[model samples]
Target: MNAKYVKRKSYLNFLQRHKDKPIIKVVSGVRRSGKSTLFLLFKQELIDSGVPENHIISVNFENMAFDELRDPQKLYRYLKKMTTEESMYYIFLDEIQHVQEFERVVDSLFLENNVDLYITGSNAYFLSGEIATLLSGRYVELAMLPLSFQEYVNWHKQNDRYKTDEAFFNDYLKSSFPYALFTDNDQELLEYLQGLYSTVVLNDIITRLSVQDVQVLEKVLATLFSTIGSLVNTNKLTNTLKSAGAAISNKTVEKYIAGILDSLIMYRAERYDIHGRQLLNSQEKYYVVDIGLRQLILRDHREDFGHIVENIVYLELLRRYQKVYVGKTKKYEVDFVAINDQQEITYYQVALTALDEQVLTRELRSLQSIDDQYPKYLLTLDQLNKTANYDGIKKMNVIDWLLQA
Candidate 1:
């Protein structure tokens, strides 16, 4: 069944701004995060803008029809034949990692003056190693993610599925992936998500990394998903796994974690010392790309609402900033430290509720310790005291903050 298209405004705006520029456009994200859908939308935009439909050439390497193009040399020759010097060609290569040594093809096509290249990959290694070195400053990456809270709400409203309670958005009753909106029942949504998760694990991670023990890798992933928004130590994780009868070493645990990260299914936030102005390498916190996926792993502990909400906040910050870190002051810890492309920093503290004087005071301490003139915000779920100002820190509702344009 074909799913209805929801306009991804933020990503569309980014593509619009970078259109026809002298650099390659790379879209990197987790599997089923809508990279292909974004390309379809942008291609239609190009056609509507009178760029000529014949000038656009797109191929999803995952399709069986393009199986032979998995050869880098053949793929390069095919693209060269499709593109001409007389007109501008927008070439989109989806799931580019399916082709072996794809960097050679990308680098070759990049030299064409009349060709504008845009590629999408579900794995981080698509930009690592040779490709990264080959196309260093010649590419601008748009890191795509699943739908934001605002997009989710807007989709529901536009599709006549609107609800006034707003609890569904916070509780995540439906998966946040774009295709989730097409599902009519929870059972169907669960099945779709399960299949998507399996493909990413089996195809993206295990196949790519040549994982010998699938059970061990899954156990490590489960541990990471259950402990979201908390600092993780490899030694302690190894000990915990050993207690559960998994014969794994600390190094193995680290390897599995790195593999999961490279798959783009999860992210790690290192500790940033706010006072010392340096990054601390130990006990970094991890966040899953989608809360719905984390729910599949940690099914029995759904009531752990605090960290779940914090995970949501972390993903939102990632969408906004170039770098998002767990901030550590002299004695306190800020929830997040977001730095944008222009080097502007913002401090945020997230809490389920801060109505109690002691609770509000504790959340405030972290932001107050940062001796900077930058903006500070306290995001909470409290309905009554959603908006307030304590000293210089501005407290606002997380839902409101997420819905911001």
Candidate 2:
């Protein structure tokens, strides 16, 4: 099937905002998350705006057409030859981290004044290590993800209306990988998710780290997927796995968890002690990158709707804010602590269904306990058109909140 022209406006807007800037535009995300498609859309936008075709250069390292340019020196020489001193050259390098010494190549390219560079990579560590020092302050990183709920609704517009609760339940069960939009059968979707997960594990994590005992690593991932919104640590996970017949050490478990986090398969939210103004190391929460990946990995994780709701809220917060953490007050816990570049804070509590008074009270107690002037929110599945404020906190339906933007 041909790739759909799903215009992810948020990411495309980012590129447009940074257009023609001298700094490198680094697009990093999980595989099959529409990174390549975003590049295609942006390239077309440039051409539609009357930019000359010959002035633009784009290449995917995985393609055989660029096989000879896999070396840093050769890639550098090729780009240098294509670049000119007059008009600007727009360069898009897909999966550029595959090349040897890619950091040196990008650093080398940043020197030319007439070229604007954009590159994509699957590994988060590629942008985290010495490359940060090499290209510090010379680039802006735009982290992309699988489809958001808004995009999910957009894709379903050609067929069923995915806005209703029944339709959203099905959407929630999906991995939201852009490619999954082309598949309808349950077995086919599951197989696609399985293959995608394997590719990420085998190539991105296992091969990249040279990890042996792949079975144990998968078991670790299974444990993580099953408990999306719970507090987890290496020691507790090792004990849990030991009782389940997987005899892995805490140290090994720690390494595996680190690898998963670095692979961008899942994200960790540290506990921030609100009143004490400190970070606690003991019980950090983990959110998988996509809910569909969680459902596919766990096979029958539908019953844990509460954590699934939390996972969605966590990812939405990430997409809207620059940083997110688990907030802890003296007596209660907040589901999410979102912060922007200006250090402004927003506290949120997410619950699946909050019609019951006890559940509603519990969800709001944490946001109420925090004595701050910053914005507070209570996000639940209860669908009431709400413009009301409760004890200085905003109460809104999670679905409405997600689709608002």
Candidate 3:
């Protein structure tokens, strides 16, 4: 049974390395992005490492079985009562945002000498400023995401055989969520994704925010999702929605985007001025957290292949824990400015394909403009033979980049 679980090696390695430290491990991500599954795998790891079953307590707040403990006070009391005799207890709370004032409970648990706390929140509500104030300098926030293309491929290879490159391309477009590897029927997968999208919109956004104009919000979403990887702020978005028959103010649009952001449904990438070494004030790009969710809501996946590649590149940078930004050169734009843990900066230009000589040169121009010798790359759908260096910038196949650890 444990073998059936796909261990997210890098993420789990992070958790395992930080094991039993005096900090709460908080895994936050979009709904159904596999937070609970990761926690289960970690819990199983604990069991296999010879931890007594009685010493570990795991609860999912969404489960009806845990309904009685949804209250913060009751949950606190239940855990307090269960481990009265334990010396070191590992407590895992899944979807902890569903619990009222959960940060208070987490704070209380942190006060205990014996408790090692881990909680998962599907929305940004879990990591609000108040929680940071409550447990300052003491919690590990692991921003999890849906499975990567490599993870999906490995999962499928374990269960069935396939042509690697073909499978990778299929995953790049259709298999948007982690659960995609668990099912073969496309329609059923879309249905599951749609249901999850609704849940994210309703619970994490509308219901949680007490939004009245659901249609306006939907229109706002339509505007955003339709233009992923492009630049459009609240003002432009508001105007677009008004033209679409939903009259909403820029202020309202701002609020809606904030709410959308808080739900983890979409992420904003601010612009970095490569010349000035500062973040620009406007024209930030927005990326939907998962391609599957976009496919589920928009009903067409084939049209936006270029932006789709950009979006995939964005998430891959995030998965690798790189600090990413849209790079602004003097006269051209770099697709991404990725700074790793070592503070090394690199510029990347992402495109669907640069098979044509003109297109290849166009893709390389921005990186070519940067005179400093930081690593610059041109990434596309071109195979190895098709990829070649231009003026010291490395040309790589996007699929090859995604497969790398």
Best lDDT goes to which candidate? 1
| Candidate 1: pairs in clash | none
Candidate 1 TM-score to native: 0.97
Candidate 3 weakest lDDT stretch, 10 residues? 166-175
* Order of the predicted models by TM-score, top scorer first: 1, 3, 2
Question: Lowest summed lDDT over 10 consecutive residues: which window, candidate 2?
Answer: 157-166
What residue pairs are clashing in model 2? 175-292
Candidate 1 vs 2: which has more TM-score: 1
Superposed on all Cα atoms, the candidates' RMSDs to the truth, in angstroms, are 1.6, 2.0, 1.5
TM-score of each candidate structure, all chains considered together: 0.97, 0.95, 0.96
- Show model 3 residue runs off by greater than 4 Å: none
Residue-by-residue lDDT tens digits, candidate 1, 1-405: 112687899899988888889988999999989999999999988988899888999999999999999999999989888886678999999999899998888888888988989999998988997779988998999999898888888777776775754575654535678888777787787788899899999988898788898998999999999999888999999999999989998888887888899898999999999989889988999988888788877778787788988999998998889999999999999989999999999999999999999998899998998888999999998889788998889999888899898
* Residue 37 accuracy (lDDT) in model 3: 89
The C-alpha stretches of model 2 lying farther than 4 A from their native spots are 1-3, 158-166, 384-388
Highest-scoring model, TM-score: 1
Q: Considering only N, C-alpha and C atoms within 3 Å, which residue pairs clash in candidate 3?
A: none
Model 3 local distance difference test score:
0.85
